[model samples]
Target: DPVVVLDFQSLYPSMMIAYNYCYSTCLGRVDQLIEQTEFSEFGCIGLEVRKQLLYKYRNDIHISPNGVVFLKDYVRKGILPKMLDEILETRIMVKNAMKMNNKKQNPSKGLNRKLDARQLGLKMIANFTYGYTSANFSGRMPCVDVADSIVAK
Candidate 1:
């Protein structure tokens, strides 16, 4: 039996956008960001100069289970979220076109197939982005934190 995975919701992309998880937004782990920024997170004042930034903007940050910290979208929108949103939107548009074409008096099967393929490709791109961050074999550095958070979501 073949499996049909319906991902119209785009959960992974949505979650990443909701949490603003991106390499550009990541400010590294708390311990590395400040001498005692980790302490600040625990309610202890840090002696480091940049400690105040984390301490004050605590609510505005998203710390993954792997201890990697990222600024919320309010602080600075991440590029991944924007890119994913566009991909999903384009997929939606393509799907709509396919649907409308199917209802036409004499729909062109070839055009419908092309539109369907385009939408599937867009969905694949949207979903594979998380894999891009977690794949250890990838040429670039993989963000374990982002991958973990995406899984957790």
Candidate 2:
């Protein structure tokens, strides 16, 4: 049997933007909301959203496949999603520069290398966002729900 192999670049990161996944936007697991007392764990606006605004904006949120809820961009644009959009846009610009540099009659190899490195660095940032989000041991503010939702999508 010949199995088809396909890979989507930055799928998780793109999904995070499309689905609006972020610590500040996340509402925690649905079941946990019923079992836990502290809605404050999600942050100030998030806490208020979870406690009160949730009812008013019940139809305006996103519940991931893994049961993690996030506020939609219309309700409250996620910080991570905005950052990712900038990163991805800059990567595209860098890639275009690389192509234009390569097409030059006498392109500088050093400039090409620099542009390639810049694009690669940006891509790597998007590729390993899950690690960035779940890096508790590295002193990062761990966001399990957002990271898990990125993978689930």
Across 1-153, the per-residue lDDT of candidate 1 in tens digits comes to 999988648788888888888866776666667555332321122223366677888898988766778889989999999899899989989999998999999999999999989999999999999888877775375766667777775
> Candidate 1: minimum summed lDDT over ten consecutive residues — where?
39-48
Clashes of 1: 0
Please give the lDDT score for candidate 1. Answer: 0.78
Judged by TM-score, which candidate is best?
2
True lDDT of residue 125, candidate 2: 87
Error of 1 at 101 (Å): 0.6
Where model 2 places Cα greater than 4 Å from the true spot, the runs are 1-5, 40-51
Model 1 pairs in collision = none
Clashes of each: 0, 0
TM-scores of all models?
A: 0.77, 0.86
